[model samples]
Target: MFEGLSHLARDAKAWPFEQARNLLARTLRIRLTDAERDLAVVLINSGKTAEAVATFPALAKPVILETGYGPSGLPHLGTFQEVARTTMVRAAFRSLTDDAVPTRLISFSDDMDGLRKIAPNLPNQAMLAEDMGKPLTVVRDPFGTHESFGAHNNARLQAFLDNFGFDYEFVSSTDCYRGGVFDKTLLVALERFDAIQKVMLPTLGEERRATYSPFLPISPKTGRVLQVPTLERHVDKGTIVFEDEDGTLTEVPVTGGHVKMQWKPDWALRWTALGIDYEMSGKDLIDSVKASNQICKALGGVPPEGFNYELFLDEQGQKISKTKGNGLTMDEWLTFGTPESLAYYIFQSPKSAKRLHRDVVPKAADEYLQQLDAYQRQEPAQQINNPVWHIHGGRPPQEGSPVSFSLLLNLVSAADAQDKAVLWGFLSRYIPGASPETHPLLDTLAGYAVAYYEDQIKPNKAFRAPDEKERAAMLDLRARLAAMPSDCQDAELIQNEVYSAGNDAGFDPLRSWFQALYEVLLGQSQGPRFGSFAAIFGLPRTLALMDEKLGG
Candidate 1:
C-alpha cells in the first residue's frame, strides 16, 4: 500500500522497519465496516465459490468492473448508487493490489432490449406508445436530439456520470450486437441452447415455457423482437428457426444483430463476451444473478463475482420504480445537496435498504460535512474507516467547512438572506478573511442553504411565543450575554452562560430549555448549537434580535 515512501532514510533508527510493519499490518487488516471493502472481495471472491475461483479471470487478466443500465428511462439516483459504489469497490481493489493490477469500469447500456412500456417520467408519450415491443434503439428520441430514445437516454446517463466525475467507458448493447462484438458469444450460446434452457425452463409458467427460447429473434417482417417458440436450432450454422408473429417460420443467424437472448441468457452472454470480473446488482436481481451464473457455466464461461445490494424505498417505502416515477431523481438531489454529499450517502451500508427522498438530503449533507471535519484529526487506521476517505478515494481534500448545513439554513432564515451574497456578507464578518475564493465549499453551501431555506425550511417554519417562565429565562440569558465583552465571540463561553441562565431559571430537563430556544428563536423544534450560532451571528446583533423576539 505504501510503495514510494522514503521512510527508510528517516533520522530515527529502525523507523523504516516500524513504518513498514504498520503498513503491512494495515494491508492485512482489510476488514473494515466500509461497504466497499466487502464489495471489493469480488476481485478476490468469485461468485458462490461453488466451483473454486482458482481460474477466475480477475486473478490473471486486467479486472473489468461492469455496471448495467436499462435505457428505458432517465438514470435515477439508484443508478448513480450502483456506479458510485462500483467505483468505490474499484478504489478499494486498487488499494489492495497496490495499484499494480489494471482495471476498467464498463457502463453497459441495454439499448437493444425491447421497449416493454413507456416511461412516465419521459416526454413525447405518444411517440413511445407506438414503439412498444421494438428495441429501444429503434424508438424515436423524444428529446429530438439523439438518433433514438435509447441513444438519448444513453447520452443523458453519460452526462449524469460525467457530471459526477465517474471513470467509466460507456457501451451500447445495440453496438455490441450489430458490430459483431458478441458474435462468438452468441454462437457459444446457440451451441449450448438446451443447456441454457435447462437452467431457465422450470422457472417459467406453462404459457411462458411453451414459447421460451434463449434467443428472441428480431422479426425480418415486423422489426419487433418476437417471443414465439423456436422451431429448430442449427448449431453449426449459428442460426435459429423461429415462428414469427404471422405464423410463417423464419430462419435467422444468431450473430450480427439478428437475435438477442432473454434477460438471464443475455446477462450470461455479456459476461462470457466481455470477461467481466465484478458487477453489483440490486436485491431484486438475486434470482436472475443466480440463473445467469448457471447459464454462464453452461456456456463454458465463468460468471463474474458481484455484490447484491438492497433496493431503495421511496417516500411511501415502496420500491423505487423507473416507470412509476416514485423515486427521487438524481437531479432533485443535486438541487438541494452537493454531489459529495450524495456520494457519502451511497458510501454507507449497502445491505440495508434506505429511504430515498428529498427529505433525506439534508441529513446526508450534514453527515458528510461531519465526516470531512473529523477526517483531519483521525489516525491512518481510523481514516480508512471514515467514509470521507473512500468518498475522496483515499486522499481527502484539505479544505473543509466546519459550519454545518443546518447552521447555514438557520442563518439564512434568521438573516432573511435571499441569496448567497447576503449569506456571504454575514460569513465575511463571522470568519474574517474567509472569502468565497478561499473556502469554496462553504460558499457553495451558502447557495444550497438559500435554496433549501426557500424550498424546505421557510414554509415549515412556525415560531412560538415563549411562556412566562421561559420568557424570564430568555430575559436572563439576554442580560447575561449583554454583560459579556462586546468583542468576545467565544461559542463555548457563550454556551456556558446560556446554560447557567436556563439552570438558574429553575427549568428542569435541560433539553427542554434548548428545545424552547429552538422553537421560540429559530422557528424550529431543533437547531445548531445556539452558542455557535450566536457567536457566528455576532453577539450584539443576537442580543438585539432577542429583544425583538422577547417583545422587550
Candidate 2:
C-alpha cells in the first residue's frame, strides 16, 4: 500500500534556505486570524502532524493549494490574479508556522478540455474550426510552435507564470490522465456513478441530465470525446460501456487513460485524490462548488476549503472575459505598470469585484508606491496589513526614494521625456544628484508614465479656456511661482503658495480654485498634488506651463 505524501513534499522542501532565513529574521508578529487557525486545526485533525515542540507549527502535513486555468485563450490579468492571491495566502500561512510546514501551489491548466469554439484572438481560426469538439491535445498549433494547440497555450501560460518567478508546480490535465495519475480516482467515480449523478443532476437542465454520464470516453474511431449516454458499468472490472458518436455501443476500460470525467465530477475527484487543502474560484461558480463539495463527500473524501472571489469587471462593468478581450492583457498591464502594482490590486478585498482597465492603472501603481513608502515609516506592527508586506512576502523591501506615479506622469508630460535617462535628467533637478540606479522604482515609474502619457493622456490634451476669474487666478499663480526661491520650492512651500494665489484671485479657496488650476495647467480636472508636481517639474518649468496655459 502506498502511503500518500503531498507531491510538494516529495519534490521540494518547505522553502529554500534563503527564504527560511528571511522568515526567521523578521521580528514583526503576524497573528493568525481565527479562520486561518482553523485551517491548521483541520490539518491536525486529518492526522498529519510533526513532533510536539514548545510552539506548534501550523500543520504537520504539507498544505496543497491549487488554481486552475482553462487554456482556451491567451493568459490575461484575471489568470494572474488567482496565482497571485493564492501565493499571498501561502505567505500568510508561513507567518503562523515555525517555517517547517511545506506548502505548494499547483498552477493547473485544463488543456485536455475539448475545443468547443474557436477563440476570437487565435490565429488560423479555420484550422481550429476543423478540430472543434476534439481535445485541445489533438488540435494542431496554428502558430506551429508546439505539437498541439494545448502545448502552445501551455507554453504561453508557463512563460507568463515564470516571468513573475511564481513558486508553483505546473500540472496538465492531459498528462494527469495519460500518465495514469488519475486512474484510482477514475475507478472510484465509475463505481459510485449513480451517487455522483444524484448530486449533480438537480442543478443541470433536464435536457443535459437526460444524456449526461459522469465519464466521457475519447472516441477511438473519431478521436473526439464522446458524451453519449452510459449503457452499462462494470465497477469491479473498472470498465464502462457507452454509446459512441456513431451510435455504436463501445466498452472501454475506465483506467489506463481510456476516459476522463466531466468537469464537476473531475473537480471533486481531483480534490479527493490530490488532497488539496485550499482552492479558489470566481463567485459565478458557487453552485458548481456546492455540487462538487457534495460529490466529494459522497466519494468519502473531504472537500478542500474554498474561496469565492468576485469577477473582474471591464470599464463598462461587464465581466472580464478572456474571449472578449475587453480587459487589459498581462502584457498591457506590465507595460504600463509594475508587477507589484498588479499584485497589490489582487491583494485588495478579495471578495469584492474590482474594475481592471487603463483608467485604473495610475492609481493602483501610486497606491503600491505609497504602501512601499509606508513599510519604511510605519512600525513593524503597523506594517502587517500593508499590501507591500504581503506583496513582498513578509520581508518587505527597504523603501528607497518614494515617487508617486501621478507625479512621474506629470514630470514626463512636462519634460516630454521618452526614456529613463531623459526623465532622470528632470528628476535629478529635484533630488540634486539622484540617478536611475539610486531610485529604481522612480526609474521604472518614469518608463510607465511615458507610456501612459502617450496612450492615456496625450490624446485627451484639451486645456480648458478658464473664465475671467480663473485667468486672474492663473496669472496670480504664475507670479507667485516665479518669485519663489529655487532652493525653497519644496512640495510644502509650493503647495502653500498655490493656495495663496487662489485666495488672491478672489475665488472660493476650497472648491473651484485648485480644480481650475489643474484644468488650466494639466488639462485634467485633478492631478498630482500641485505642490509635488511643482517640486518635481521644477519651479521654472512650472512657471512656463502656467504662462503657456494663460496665453502669456
Candidate 3:
C-alpha cells in the first residue's frame, strides 16, 4: 500500500499527501464490532451513561476508570499500556456522550506494599537488603531523590505520565493509609475477616493457608510489615493481637494506620471504598481478581466492571519482568518513537498477547503516521473509526508530510546522515521546498531514525558478499540507474530496470530478483520496496550506493 503511494508521489513530482490520505481512508478504516457494541451497552446500563453516549452519542454519567501500579520498580512500557488503553476507552466514552458527562482517571500506586525482595535495578542494593519485608514507604531512597524508594518510583511514574499529557489523579497507597483514608475500609475488612478468608483461603495452597491472615500488622520493633498469624481479633475494639519480631505479644489497632490487609482483601476493600467504576488486570491475575470480587461482595459492595488484558512478552516470547529487566523501557521507546505510536501499540487488539521490543518500534511509528495521514483526509464517519482520533482525544493534529519510519531509516543509511539537518538536506532534494517547520512529523521521524540506526540497526548490520550472478546484476542495475534521466519518474523507472536486470540475470522477477536486491543492499531477505526507496533516496544517490555495494 505504501509502495504504491510512493510511486504516485514520484510520478506526480509531489508528495501526493492527498492520495496517501485517500489510500488510508479506503484501507485503514474501523468500526465497532458486535462485542464492542455489547460492551458499550453494558457501560450504559452500568451508569457510564456519558461513555455510552460518546461511543454510540445518541445514547449518555460520570465514570471512574482506575489503573493500578506497583512502585517496587521503575514504571515500564506495561505500565504505560494500561494507562493508554484506559484513556482510549475513556475517549470512546466521550465519543458516546454529551460534553457535560464527567470522567476521571485514577492512577493508583501501591506504595504501601511490603518490599518482599530487593529490586535488582536499584542502586545501593545492600541498603535495600536490610529493609526487606518493610513497607516500601519506609525504605530509604537509594538515589536520595525522594523521601522513600516508593516515593522516588512514584515520581518517575508521574513524570512519564505528565510527558504524555495525561490528566489523572495520582493516589499513593501510603498516603491513603497514613491519612486514615482507609480507616473505615480497614474496619470493615477486620469485622468481616472470617467471610473474606473463606473467599481467599480456598485459592491458596496448604502451606500458604497456614500463614494467611487478612490483616498484616506492621512490627513496631523491626519496622517490617509482618504476615504472621493473628492471635486474637477484637472486632469491638478494632485491634488485633500479634507477636512482634521480638517474640513479644502486642495489641495494635487495625485502623488508623497500624495495619494493612493482604493484597486480595485490600483490593476488594479498595473497590468498595473508592466506588471504582472500571478497572483492569493482567490475565495472570484472573483468579486473584475473582477472589477479590467475591470478598467485595462479602463486604456488601459490587466489584467494578473490567477486562483482563494479556501480558506482554519479550521478543523471545518470555514474560516481561521488572526483576529480569528483560524488555523495552519507557525511555528507550520515547527516544526512538513518538508517544502516539506507543499509544497505538497499546490500542491494537489489546486483549491479545503482543511482543514489546525494540524491533517493533519502526512498524508502530509508521502505523501511527499512517493513521495521522488518514485521519486528516477522512470524512467524519471514517474519522470516528481512525484510532488516531481516539488517541488524540478526538482532536488529532493536522497532517504533516507522509514520511514513513522505514523510509527515514533507509535514508539515514543511504546518506550516512548523523542528524536531522543532514537528513533534511537529502529530503529537500526529493521533496522540493520542504522544511522542518513544514513537516514536523517527518522531521521528528528523521531524528528517531538516526537514533534507532545508531542503537539498533548499525550494530548488527551485515552486508552479504554477492555471488557472481548477483554481483553482475547489481553492477548492471547501477549502470541502468546512472543512465536514467535525473528528472524521470524514478519509482517506475527503477522498477522497470530491476525487472530488466532480473531477466538479464536469468532470475525470476517475482521472487529471486527482489530477494537478491534486499540481501545485497539491506542484508535482509525482505525490506521496504526497493523501487520506492530508490525514488525517495534519489536516482544518483541510489546508483552510488549500488556501486559502493558492487565494489566498483
TM-score per prediction, in order, is 0.88, 0.88, 0.85
RMSD of each: 7.2, 7.0, 8.7
Candidate 2 clashes: the total is 0
Ten-residue stretch with the least lDDT total in model 2: 1-10
Q: Kindly list the per-residue Cα lDDT of model 2 for residues 409-511, writing each as its tens digit.
A: 8777767676667778767877866888787777878888999988888788777888988887778778788788865548988898888877777776455
| Residue 251, model 1, lDDT | 96
Off by over 4 Å in 2: 1-59, 509-511
Off by over 4 Å in 3: 1-61, 467-476, 489-493, 496-511
Enumerate clash totals for all models, in the order shown: 0, 0, 10
lDDT for 31 in candidate 3 is: 25
- Model 3 clashing-pair count: 10
lDDT per residue as tens, model 3, 402-510: 5678878877776767787888876787787788888887888888999998888777777787899888888888888878886554676678888888788899556
Instruction: For candidate 1, write residues 446-482 as lDDT tens digits.
Output: 9998998888888999989999999999999999999
